[model samples]
Target: MEVHAHSHTERKKWTHYLWEFLMLFLAVFCGYLAEYQLEHKIERDREKQFIRSLLNDVSTDTVKLNNLINVRNQRENWLDSLTYVMNSQNPRSFPPADVYYYAIFIPRSIPLRFIPNDGTIQQLKSAGGLRLISIIGYDIGVRNLTRIGEVEETLINDYRGIAHYFFDGIVFDSMLDANNIPRRPKYAPQLYSFSDQNLHELNYKLFSIKAYNRASRRESKRLLQQAENLLTILKKEYHLK
Candidate 1:
């Protein structure tokens, strides 16, 4: 008789099950990490795009600011000459034509209406995450922009308001035909004739006007420097030109 050995298959050990469970947990964890990493990369890319746009906006602002400064400087010089002539004993030498030229043209470069290119900043604010540009950069940029806007509005607007009142009644007969440069406002108010112009009053008013203009000029300089500094930081940080 042949001895028959009952063959029984060995059951899977508990260690095997434990090892499988570990492997599944590890796979799930790794997949989650990969997904998280992908999301981070995407957000980072979006942030950089926004930064570049902001850089462009700032650059535009810088150009505009410089132009304004230059124009204002020339205006200041013209104002100085006009007031100097008025204060002189021989005010008749300069003639009303000269004064009218400076007054009409200088007022054209009204400082109160400076429009900063803030499209990117507005979008950033609306999008609800300024942290995209980094907390520090965002704060600095916003603060500077706000400061510049406020100063310009206050100082420049004040100057314009004063100019409007001061220039009242001092009319020019040939503003429209004088030069083909700027079109006269459709609702241009008529000016008083040279005979009706009062030199004493004009000279007195000029003192205050000059003060306001000088103050505005100072503030403009400060704004330009600050904006340039911020632009420098952005360029260096982002490796942008």
Candidate 2:
């Protein structure tokens, strides 16, 4: 029988094993860091997209608010003139045509209303969440402005209800031209009743509508300011145009 000499291999030292373990640990740690960075970048990108969409919505709202403010100014002027004519010592003495002109605006006027542009905000609520745009505080402002707008509509309708006691629908209906603009009627305008009581109650209703209209306009201006402020901050923070 032939005896074979056993081939001996050098065993790895403890330090070598330790070095291998360190390299493996470092590989895993670096991979985890890379993954975390990627996720963070994705989140940041999503946030920026949301902000851009919100900016567009706010920009649109600002333009509408400005236009609405101007309309409200005109409406307020009409209300003032109407109130003056009604409160006169002798309301009946005033031109029926003038009274009819202003009374029609109090009822069935739709051009004076405003609703906030909240499409992006609604989308955010369904998507990630409002938390993404929490810094702007625009959502709360829009909601509040919407509530005010609804209330103004209700007030306007109520004013119309009270106005019928003093104004003649026939006269008001005749004053509107083909374009729905108040135009001088071919026939003389008239009122349903010019009694002191009707005039008094109608005046009160006008006052209510006027107050709410002013409030709504002021709220719109405030919301406009907030939108502008948020827009500035977002532009500066994101280096956006």
Candidate 3:
């Protein structure tokens, strides 16, 4: 039998295997770091985009709040004027048509012009993104604004309750004649005629209505200032337009 010469095969060293393992581990670790950084970047960009959108909502709220404030102020003034007329020694001196025009203006409640532009805010809050707003005091500021709005809403609803519960419906029914009410600009039309006793009753109701309006007007003005302050902080903190 011919003995075949064994081919010399060198055994690989354990250190060489260990070196290959180390290289593989390092590559994986670096890839992980790169992926993590990419994800972090994406999250930051998304956060900024959401903040910008939220800023627009706040701006809209600011406009609405201002307009509501103006309406409340004007209505309060009209209520004051009506109070003077009703309490006058000679209620007969003032033309009844003029009284009707002003009295008819007493709204049951100021139309809800206050629309909180909270869509983006609600979305961010629902998604747990409010935590991402890093501006110092921003979160606190937003919370305060919401609280102010709550108080304003509560006061408005309270006044509505007072009006409905305390007021006689006869005045509103007599004042509004839809067909004849809006006949012309600056035109004073005849309203449902009031007897002397009816005038006495209406005079009392008008006083109560004026009192309720004054309370609501005060609340509205306070809310307006708070809203303006919040907007100022938002602009300063976010550098928004």
Query: Candidate 3: misplaced stretches above 4 Å?
Result: 1-9, 108-112, 132-241
Model 2, residue 35: C-alpha shift (Å): 2.2
Stretches of candidate 1 exceeding 4 Å from the true structure? 1-9, 109-112, 131-173, 177-204
Best by lDDT: 2
TM-score of each: 0.70, 0.86, 0.64
Task: For candidate 2, give the lDDT.
Answer: 0.79
Clashing pairs for model 1 are 171-191
Worst 10 residues of 1 by lDDT: 187-196
Give one digit per residue, the lDDT tens place, for model 3 in 54-152.
Answer: 667766766766776676677677667766875677655666666655555564343533456667777877787665333224344445545554554
Instruction: Please give the CA lDDT of all the candidate structures.
Output: 0.62, 0.79, 0.59
C-alpha lDDT of candidate 3 relative to the true structure: 0.59
The candidates, ranked best first by lDDT, are: 2, 1, 3
Q: In model 2, what are the clashing residue pairs, if there are any?
A: none
Error of 3 at 29 (Å): 2.3
Give one digit per residue, the lDDT tens place, for model 2 in 15-112: 99999999999999999999999999998898789889888888898998899888889889989989998887777787877778777776554676
Tens digit per residue, CA lDDT, model 1, 165-192: 3355335334545553533444444333
Candidate 3, clashing residue pairs?
none
